[model samples]
Target chain A: MTSEPLVLGIETSCDETGVGIVRGGTLLADAVASSLDEHARFGGVVPEVASRAHLEAMVPALERASREAGVRLDDVDAVAVTSGPGLAGALLVGVASAKALALGLGKPLFGVNHLAAHVAVDTLEHGPLPQPCIALLVSGGHSSLLLVEDVTQTVTPLGATIDDAAGEAFDKVARLLGLPFPGGPYVDRAARTGDPAYVVFPRGLTSPRDLERHRFDFSFSGLKTAVARWVETREREGQPVPVDDVAAAFQEAVCDVLVRKALDACRTHGVNDLLIGGGVAANSRLRAMAEERCGAAGVRVRVPRPKLCTDNGAMVAALGAQMVARGRTPSGLDLLADSSMPVTVVAR
Target chain B: MLLLAFDTATPAVTVALHDGRSVLATSTIVDAMRHGELLAPGIATVLREAGADRSDLTGIAVGVGPGPFTGLRVGLVTARTLGHVLDIPVHGVCTLDVLAAAAEVDEGQVGSFLVATDARRKEVYWARYSDRRTRVDGPHVSRPAEVATPDVVVGRGATLYPDAFPNAAGPLDPSAADLARLVATGSVPVLEPVPLYLRRPDVAEPTARKSVLTAR
Candidate 1:
């Protein structure tokens, strides 16, 4: 039997310099060096700090990944790197390193999209995805829906957030609630003991009037504003704001709107398969509600493990391997980093 | 002995190779924003021009910066990787020292000198040095207009904000020759090349969970 192609992936789309090695769908090694802590104090990623962290971490991560994979750098068949949709400086570090490694090893280089890789990663864990699935990606930098015909080719965007991604909203709201930086995990923890149905937060861009015009699009900025107003009112009235109740209620509002739209897309496209990716997919409420809703609609849903759900190198590698298997062209050494690179571009 | 030296802390990427006593090859690409894209190719070209391969490398040297995060990473990553691949020890020379070295050799001055490079966002990475102890004064990210008194001020940061240091401090000459000499002699120190990000990223992601390393 022939062996699977050995693919090495590098990710520097954000604060982490992630290096991973994969044999087909099996993850051989995953090494991530994150500058998240440095960014946390600033309440976000400092572009300059992230770029430097990626630079310092690149070689060490590559070495760790190689050792973990039990393979030499020369053994890597093709090198894949996240080339865009991130901090330009951060993305460049990985791109430049990948180019050097590829040139030195005489291997092909595949520049993959940070967002599409999130969707592609489900294949590594859940096996091949059903054709024409609706993909909902929610992360610190992005929130979008895609009609993915195949993981390697044809990712058509349906709609996206106009302002303030869901993850950003979560962080901002958590901060407003005095939860902490990186609001997702904080809200997730607080919601565990509170009631999700306690307060009715407005569903952004989902009103009966707005739905007709921007049905699939999302807007978390308004929702974040609503949370801020509610907290202000509570403080004005000399009332102690129950943290768990607010966390649960706010999370429910977001989860309810997200699930409703996701299933609506499934029905609209006549597709029964729905795939969830990105950091927000780690939400317990989102996962539980999605299972409940998709089950009732007879639609299949797939979510990767928590580690894979967040920004990492394995997903980029998985997408790159798919491109190679499908005979896709490799990128030139002159490939530049695009901080706002659109998802439709194949990264050639 | 042949050594490869480069610095990406500033917009300009300067590369050089020294064969023990003299310079064999040197190249500098000026692009404040494209250090990551231009650095590796520049290094490869410099080495090729010197008629040296990876196996011929005796040591690798880089100017570890208090510079912009992006450019600094590109140089450090490339130098460290080259050193690891070639199985040679890598040295990190302060960007200021490199400037001082260049000043000493080119200007033929034998006294103290001050070096400063732009840290962007309205700040400068500054340092002070003499022939004996190279005193790294401030890697602080602050406005150049606010730099304190110094003996000599040089590098692009000084050129951009001349008012930052208006004393007879000395000459403001910028060159790559000193970096080359440091690489050849293994005189630079060995330190972690992490960026000196004085502030946080614009967006914060809360990490309340204790680290896995600490949890167990």
Candidate 2:
């Protein structure tokens, strides 16, 4: 039997330095070293702090990934790394480390997109993505919709959030409620025990009259402020605030808008397959709502395991493997890290 | 004993080839914030001029800084990767130690000295060396005036903030020869070199929160 190609993936776009090894879409190992605890005190990422954390975690994460994959470093056939759309300092650590590995091993190098990797990871779990699908990438840093025609070739932007992203809204609202740093999970948990209709928070960019104007676009800054103002008014009036009730109401507003927009795009574009990826996709309420709404609309929804829902190396490597399988060209040694690398094109 | 040393701590890419006997060739390109564009090409030119290549390297040395985040990553990453590729061990010498090694101090009198480098954002990256010329405390970003020190201060960092370091070094006196010599001694620690980004990025996306003054 011919040995399958061993593709190693490295990701350091954010607080986590993740490394994973895969063989023909089969996940062998997935290791991540997170600096979430370090940033928890600040309630948001400090770029400098995140960069230093990447430098420290790079070597150790790679070692753990190789060990778990049960393969020596030399056994790796190709290397894939996330090259953009992140903190420049943080991105450099992963890119530079990857280049060195690729140069040393004399292996082919593939620079994968962090956002595309989020979409590509689904193939690892669900076999293959149906072509002509829409990808709703909602993370702390990004909230955009894309029309993905292929895993390796085409990803055209459908729409994106105009102001604060969906995840950022969760974080901001959570802070207003005096919750933890990562508001997504905290609010999701708190909402389960509370009532969704208690506050009647606004759903941004959603109006029957304005439906034709921004059918696919999203806006969360208004939602975030609305939550803040509601909390402030309760405190000012000395009306005892119900944290759970507020959390539930805020989460419902976000989910309601997200599902409604996604379904609208699906119906308009006639693309029935909807895929959601990123950190906020890990929210239980969002997952349940997506399932319920997609079912009612008779549209299919594919979401990776919760672990793959957030940033990870497996997604980057999976994207790389798919590119290699399709004979996509690799990036030049001089490829610069575009901190704002768009979610379109491969090996630029 | 062949040693390859380079620093991207500043806008300049300084490359040196030392055969343990003498310095063969030292080349520098002053492109300051263009390290991502000039570093590799500068490396190629330096090695070509020295009549050597990656295979001829025995040990690699790098200035593990207290420098700008993006620029410092290039040098450290290149040095570490090169060390791994050549199967030669790598050594990380402090940027201040390299500067101190080049100081024109009195031959027998190792007086108290301060080494400061521009830490950007109206601050200096500083470390103090005593009579033994041992580092006291730093690789941190602080006002030069605030970096409690004994006497004469040195390094380009002090030069950038003149008022901060009243007694500072003359110019970019930091040489790769000094870095090469330190690596040969094997005295510096092998800890992974981290870019000393002491603070967060200055710019953040605008938050939609009402101004605190408005709330008040």
Candidate 3:
């Protein structure tokens, strides 16, 4: 039997510089160096700051990953990297680093898509993916439902956010609530003790009229505006805002809409399995709601652990291992980091 | 000593392969927005032209630019990665110095001249250099109109604002051969491969924390 291919993956698509090593289906190392603290004061990631941080963290992350994996750099069979759908400067850092490794070690290079990697990461945890699974990818930068016939091959776009991404809305609303920079987890925590029915926040794109047209598509900008207006009006009336209630209501609305639409896509496509990935998948509310709703809908739900949901190199390595096992062609040396690379193209 | 050098700080992407004494091969392409796409292929081409395998490279050199943040990071990251993977020392050279050395080589006699390159937003990245091809002062970004006119000016920045620099020579971009030569000659200080972003980043941090409670 052929030994499993050892792949080293690099991901600096955003604020995290991640490096991971995988031997076929088994994960050896997953090391992440986040610049989240640097971006915290800014309330959002500054692209230039993230880029600078990646340059500093990349070498160290690689070293750590190799050491953790107990694999020497020379032993890795191939290199994989996230090529796009991220900050251009950030993506370039990982891409350049991947290229150098591929060139230096004389290994094959795989430039994988960031979004698809999110979906592919589940395979590492849940064994091989059930074909024709509906994947809901929610993060600060993107929110989309993808129909995956094969994580390594075809991923069909079902619907996506027409306005602000789900995580962006969380961050903005969290700011209004005086929460932290990356507001998802904070908002999730704040919502725990509050009443979800205190105020009925609008569930975006769920109106009967919207369902007829944009049933799968999402729009959160209006919901964000509504939250802001509600807060401002309470301030104008000199009423003390019930921050906990507001957090709970907002989280309920967002999760309700997300889970509703994701299950709808699964039903429409006749897919029995649903997978949720990306940073927003780390939200406790989203996970619980998705599991409950999908359970009732007779759709099996698959979500990697929270650590795997966020941006990491292990996902890229998993996808790369899949590509190699399936005999997919490796990317040429001239591969470019495409910031707006669509989710359909898994590799470039 | 087999060396591989590249620069993507300017609009052009340059790559070169060199021995200690002479450049074995070099290629430069003026591609404004495609540095990420062009650079790896350019390196492969140069290495092939020089009849050297990628594994044969003993060291890597790259331009640590005072250029646009996006383009400049590509070369630096690439150099650093190569160095880390190959276990070789990566040398970082000021891109402006490469242009100055090129100018000196081209003109044979170089007095005090300014090396300027496009910094976008109508500003130029300018540095003063002496006749010995040494960087005298300023890897600064300034409005072309505010820059002190020099006896001779080199680079795309001088050509762009002709009225500001009337004595400006024709266009010049940093070359890969010069980047390789800088490492070969040991004329310039080889600093840690950190980006020379002379200006503060555009994004600002939040000034004051928002109040969670209303004063009322």
List DockQ for all candidates: 0.22, 0.29, 0.54
- Model 3, range B1-216, lDDT digits (tens) per residue? 899989888999999998999999998999889888788888889988988987788998889988988888888888888888888899888888888877733455545888889999999998987753678898999999998594688899988888888777644798998889889878777877888888887788677544444466
Of candidate 2 chain A, the 10-residue stretch with the lowest lDDT total is A330-339
Worst 10 residues of 2 chain B by lDDT: B206-215
lDDT of 3 by residue, A78-194 (tens): 999999889998999899889888988889999999999998888889888898899999999999999999888798888899999999999999998888889999999999998
Candidate 2's residue-wise lDDT over A191-294, tens digit each? 99999999899999898765677778899998888787778787778998899999999999999998888888788789999999999889888889999999
True lDDT of residue B190, candidate 2:
46
Error of 2 at A135 (Å): 0.2
Give a tens-digit lDDT track for model 1, residues A1-348. Answer: 978789999999988889988888888888999898887776767887787678778888988998999988778889999988988878888887887677556689898889889998898899887888999998888888888887776888888888988889889888878887789999999999998888899998888998988898899988887778788778767999999999999999888888888888899999999999999999999999999999999999999988998988888888888888788899876667778888888565
**Model 2: CA > 4 A from native:** A1-4, B16-27, B36-58, B77-88, B102-116, B126-155, B158-178, B185-216
Better of 1 and 2 by DockQ: 2
- Writing each residue's lDDT as its tens digit, candidate 2 over B1-216 gives 878887777656677878887778787777666665455555555678888865777987777777777878777876776565467777776777777667655626536777777777778777776732467776678876687444567778766766766666544645666677666666444445555556665535435546322445
User: TM-score: which candidate is best?
Assistant: 3
Candidate 2 docking: what grade? acceptable
For model 3 the TM-score comes to 0.96
What ordering of candidates by TM-score runs from best to worst? 3, 2, 1
TM-score of each: 0.86, 0.86, 0.96
lDDT of 1 at A28: 86
